[model samples]
Target: MTSVSSKKCNKEEYSFVYGDEAVSYEVVRKPAVEGLSHQKSQRKIAIKVHPSCEVVVIAPEDTEREDIHKAMMKRAKWIYDALKEFRGHLEHVQPKQYVSGEMQFYLGRRYVLKVVEDADALPSVKMTRGKLLVTLTRFNDGKTSMVRTLVSRWYKARAERIFHERLSELVPHATWVEGIPSFRVLPMTKQWGSCSAKGSLMLNPHLIKAPKECIDYVILHELCHIAEHNHSEKFWRLLTSVMPNWKEVKSRLDGLAELYLNE
Candidate 1:
């Protein structure tokens, strides 16, 4: 007969004061390697501060509680700075008013909204010259929701067409990846895009507002997940193989979030 013992894992949450702010974070312990002694296995802790300002700490199964605390304290300044910057960006985000001369973002460029009323013309939205030309059959007071809905539909249509085109252009470069995954454009509150274990990708419609390169970076990032699911070392190496300047592009996308996501 063979005897076996199972290892137990659990997650704990802790709060700490940083720069006069109470910051809470979660600590998780999970097995990282198999057939290795606990002392010999990788024990380094990993910390991530998400765009939504959520902090998570992942550590080896046998890591000490005090060590996690020490690590958090060491990185306190970096965490504080990131939170401050994110808050500053949030402060500037305001809902769209859909009025003429109001700024709208498209392909990393700013365009002024120009609402035109043409009873005979079809209700449509397009870029004429440099401005976003929104033509409607009639304009009345308290019709902002109608205008917003029409513009939203137009953006979604463009996102569907352009995202597919870009995916077709970039997928060939990833030789190791096989089969084109279906994608959908929708609004997401916390993430720009995500690839599910199933062969489908969900992209934020707001992404259509970003630069072409930034959009490419995001698509490639999700595609790489088909090859490597987790954000492990292998996943990043795969992403870099395709887009070496992904970090710079990612930064630009994050900065532009304030403009597009607020709407």
Candidate 2:
């Protein structure tokens, strides 16, 4: 394999020839694993293909280029398959207009938007009779921006409450976790949830649009990170010990991303 490094890029991204094809992937340097040589670390090189077909390779800072290239080649088929599937999903994603009659998702169920004009009532959003009802005062015009803001605020509020509840319910399963980690709900582009070494958890507010089972999967996944920091075999074992059906739940959660992630 031949590698061509990019000098102008801020990130450590490179283009390489794998077989007859040339591909570009971002390189992220991570801390080296303890008790293992630089080259022999099992996670010295790890690959992730995002829903946008962006490829990233995480490696130890001291790892050689040859090791990264070899690892990428070993996962060539899986990478191509993932890219193809992501491309298919992208083709069907239409931009939302935030208009009346538009479809919205909450907790794995679809709800139709119903906008109403109420001169005496304050602008608000709520679910009534299986549909999302947005009541606005006459002083405010029913613009897309106004509608989006109302809906976004509603989702954020619900996400905060639901995420906390789910975390509390699942904490009992993960006995390794000592104290409850503080959590915040925010918008994230590339991940469902993340945990910091300082015992803080950040959850993607968009996850509220997915099913309860899928939401639980994300919470449990981050909780496992509290005990195991990296995506090592031990991390998977700890996660499996808590939720045996996490694999199936994770697959379903991945499939729901295209529907919720508008941008």
Candidate 3:
């Protein structure tokens, strides 16, 4: 989820007005590769819109500026549509205020958060009477740092336990995996889970807010990476073999990601 755009020294920047919006984009020239033929070297211009709303154009070195502009203009509508979608996602994932009556999620279920001030009670968090209750011995209604801390800790603990349990159930189906690969629970802004080159996995704690099947989909996804590191055809094939309807599950997860990845 954390994507840091690389700074390119040799790049050209341009901006054009599209309706009421002024769109900015950069073009990075691509050098001809050694193995590529002359015709292949004249590659078509490639346009990419990043999650951070960065628009980048990759083009052959010999491509004229005017030609690049034409290509960009042709895709301007698509680019703007993509940008609007990501911007909406960013706006939706705002930080929580942790108010007593605020709603919270767990395992795809909603719970009303109730902060209770009990001078003699120890600080604790628990689900009681269908509510996520936070008991504070030294509660201050004005400051909610303690509430945030307690709720986050509880989420991390549950994520660690549930993620491991789901991984266990799905790993047996991933015939390529050796054993239960080590994994860590962490908070990520834009990723549900990832598999490292060393086969270790990182699952976002917020993902525990999703349903059990969704969690299994993410775990199975990383497990597929153990054998096929890159997202090549084989990688996707391996994933589909294990979870036949993975595409449907993935789309369902994508539809609910904005809600689940909340603070």
Which should have the higher TM-score, number 1 or number 3? Answer: 1
What TM-score, over all chains together, does every model reach? 0.66, 0.66, 0.64
The digit string of per-residue lDDT tens for model 3 on 17-114 reads 66678778887898877787867676578888766778889988987777777887788789889889878766767678887888788898889899
Model 2 segments beyond 4 Å from truth? 1-92, 139-142
Q: Pick the winner on TM-score between candidates 1 and 2.
A: 1
lDDT tens readout by residue for model 1, 1-263: 11122233554777678756788788778776778777655457888776677788888878887777888888888977877877766776788888787788788888889988899998889998889989888889846776788889988998998899999999998776676779999899878899999858999888998898988998999999888899999999999999999987887687668778766
Ranking by TM-score, best first?
Answer: 1, 2, 3
lDDT (10s digit) by residue, model 2, range 1-263: 67677745478888777667677889888878788875577455778887777899998887777778778878877887787788886786778877778778999998998888898899899998889998878534546778788999999999999998998889888898876779999899889999999868999988999999999999999999998899999999998998899987886778668878772
Q: Of the candidates shown, which would achieve the greatest lDDT relative to the real structure?
A: 2
Q: Provide the RMSD of all predictions against the true structure, rounded to 1 decimal.
A: 8.9, 7.6, 7.5
Q: Global lDDT of each model?
A: 0.82, 0.84, 0.83
